[model samples]
Target: MRDKETRLKRRMEPALTPWSGTTEATDWSLPEDLLQQASRRLSILCVVAAVLWGIGLFIGNSFPPRFAGLNGHPYPWPGNLVGGLAITAAVAMWLYIRLGHARPATLDVGLAFLVVNAFAIGLLDEWAPREVRNRSVSWIAVVILTCAMIAPSTPRKTLFAALVAASMDPIGALIAHLRGVAVPAAAETFIQYWPNYAAAFLAVVPSQVLQRLGRQISRVRDAGSYQLVQRLGGGGMGEVWRAEHRLLARPAAVKIVRPEVLGAASESDVRLITQRFMREAQATAVLGSPHTINVYDFGVTKEGAFYYVMELLVGRDLVSLVRVFCPLPANRAVYLLRQACHSLAEAHSRNLVHRDIKPANIYVCRMGLDYDFIKVLDFGLVKFGDRASTRQNLMTADHVTSGTPAYMAPEIILGNVETDPRADVYALGCVAYWMLTGQLVFQAETPMKMFVEHLHGTPVPPSQRTELPIPRDLEAVVMRCLEKDPQKRPDAAELFQMSCQCKASVPWDHEAAREWWALHLSEFTRGLTLAMPAAPAVSSSPVTR
Candidate 1:
């Protein structure tokens, strides 16, 4: 009952607070990808605006009224100045995009140009003919409002720019009046500026409000669906929660990560991590193997937190199982390793390398009638091959240490991100050794020492490391996987086949598994006191003898 109430509170929890800070644009305020796309589109718009400005200038000067007294003038100084500002802005934006500084400074440059253009045009209106001057402030306000709407900036920034631009027209008119220019009557001047301000305010307010509303709806919708039931573990990157879908009552595990956890990382680094994370989740979701954990959904929160939900398994991981039960018999190890191999085979076929595979990541679950069902977990450190073009490689580039030191393949430790499925094969061998001998293939006091051993030390065979009798075939397969040279390690498919051929004195059949679980989980089995049904025999058994 207490747990249910906690879940209810989590469900009722509001969406995370919208990011708060000064209204001024910052790299963290919006998604980096959105900024880049908006920057490119805005750059194009600036170039187009410049082109239109030049054409309008040419036509106005070629005709009479607008440029009557300015016939054969070298250049319309006021108009040319505004035009030059537009062209300069266009060039700067183009360069900014080409140089890849768009996210941090793109909106800044755009807003600067809009404000400057408004003031420049307003100053030009001071010398226009009475007919043009009468409506000049209104025209300038429209231009400023238009530019703000199309800028790469956020709604707040756009609205701020619109307000400032609109006010400039009145300020410019006041300056002209003070400078002894042939200004309009005070009432007329007031009427001209007030209407322009009103129109600009109306134009900007609705668009910004609608934008804010849309974002709010999206945030509420995202946070409304799932309720966290219990806290799972977390690491440097993210936290995991045991959660349930409100509508379906389906249990799941959700992993959540904040963009701020990246600490001092630049926008590009954060973007790369987000991209890699999504790609990893998508790839894992499609593995199609029953042994692979399933992903249900994934998305980012309004507050820049990333999350994904996966099927929740209620069972001990191989690490805990081995720690409590000591070294597993050769038959049980064969049973578990073959299932893991099936999962890895599917991942390998999809051109994914699960860079971090260890005992903790391989789960042993009791599923319906089947006990000791294997579910491979945690593909967060997967590396996509060149063939997997849909996913971009991390910009930090894979030279850095990424996987757990104990189980990481030697090739990965040596900074080879391009290492193939064989790297995973090696890690699987380490896991197999740990399962068979109740210890890692190599033991060291420090990570560096372990890395050194994995890089240069020869691993003792599983059979030699333990008194328990491991099948010769299974030991050979495990030893081959621990080979330092990746080329020497058998691929996942071959390992699967070899595990199928391994012979053991006592095969861990379904009945044996059921009996073992009944003893280990006495309280769980109390509701099933009826006589157990006869179990089916293994056909083309993965474990022999």
Candidate 2:
């Protein structure tokens, strides 16, 4: 086991090194949330600036005689044309950013506009008649300060951009002299441009302040001995983060339920949600099966967010597995299903029913030297059969039904408060049908239509839907599990026994699994070796019913 782990680490070193939490790594990485925030701020500023420019041009051109004393000369036609073009450009850029199609390049595009706008302002200042040239407020200064405030960046980067923008005023003065326009003397020039340069230097203060605050928040992301590295994904209830053990250097995934999600509910609803979350953690932690996800620790943050740390697995969930590749062969489907049965068997023995048993919640991972290892995840909707009636009442008080619509059993849709382990058996049969045919048992337009189908529709056999041959015995076992009556469906233990007896032309074993992965999914495995944050492990799919 130690040797296998070492080999796995060595294989993942190239991809993991960039995210190892060093200063250089931090400088290079920019989260998507930050990018979108910067884009939105820049878009708003551009629109405001454009509107003000248009207003100034309209007023000055309309009442030239009244303003003639203010500038000591007529506003030049070239200056007016430059202002018009600038406004048009700004509006175009605003539309691009606001539409959100070019989000990844938004910061780069915004910075380019900032530099160009500063130069345009300098040209307008040069054209301003002598009286107003040096006395007017530095519009360039306002632009620099606003951009610095909105975009979070390293102080060094902010300083560099500021300096570039500030130099435009001096550069503009030189251009005026070359064009034979009367320009200010050297000492007077310094007085005119000093404010812009000063503003440039001061902009770094906000940049440094924001960077420090970001670091402080990162420090506060610790949950017991684990430190969150990056956000993997989030849902309505909470977020999941990629984390590592402080002392052990082991990689893990942490799921957090923030206080605000609970704060929005009434006090009684808060109690019920908190109780359900705690039960999920407790139930998952006690299970001994290797097929079940292993919980390492659970706690609440100082801010009242509930969190649980679990082992990070490396592979795609069943949904991605089928979507990327094709439907599994008869032998391979049986091999994977038997492992899932192992996990369900253990949970059922403890009177636990996994209410959500869709393909997205079942993962196929590479564990140590073993490929195709199954890890059942997301027990958030797990039902305790011993207290089924009372827990069901509490869970459904909000008029929300748990479990995915496509995989829900007939009894669950009918509002049977005492749903048993057989509901999971029915869902597992849906999974088998999906694996063999690459489709759901019933198709419908909405959750209600899906519920109706599960209640009244008869499923087509896997063999009839696919060209690949399925053994008669295996097909019988799947059909038995999909029976509408709870009494007719086999228990998890019996399901496993029946699967083991089914014969296929070829058996799926370790060597076959390894060869298949290397041929079809080698790149995916390497990229996700330290980041299995998909679906229920990080972000969960929305439950329909």
Off by over 4 Å in 1: 1-224, 387-391, 395-398, 523-545
Give a tens-digit lDDT track for model 1, residues 1-545: 45643543353233223333222332235444555666776677677767876775786557656555642332465567666776676677667667777764676677776777667656656554354444644666677666655543555566677667666665666666676555777667667678556655665664465445434344334534767655557765776666667778566677766555644245555555665456556667767899998877776675545577787665678777889889998898998999999999988887788887888788887655678899887777777766444234542443468778999888888886476788899989989999999988889999999999999998887778899987778888888888888888889998899899998888888888778878885433344322221122111111001
Q: Model 2, 1-545: lDDT tens per residue? A: 45643543353232221112334334423445555666788888889879988887887688787756663332556668877878987998899886774443565566667778888887777765455665665788888888888763567767777878887776777777776667888578768878788888888897777656654353345366888776666754666777778778578877776554454345555556655555566678778899999888775443334677888766777887888787999899999999999999999998888888988778888887788998888887887777644554345454567888999999988877777898999999999999998999999999999999999999889899999899999999888888989899999998988899889999999899999988876743444344334443432321111
Give me candidate 2's TM-score against the actual structure: 0.61
Backbone clash total, candidate 2: 0
**Residue pairs whose backbone atoms clash in candidate 2:** none
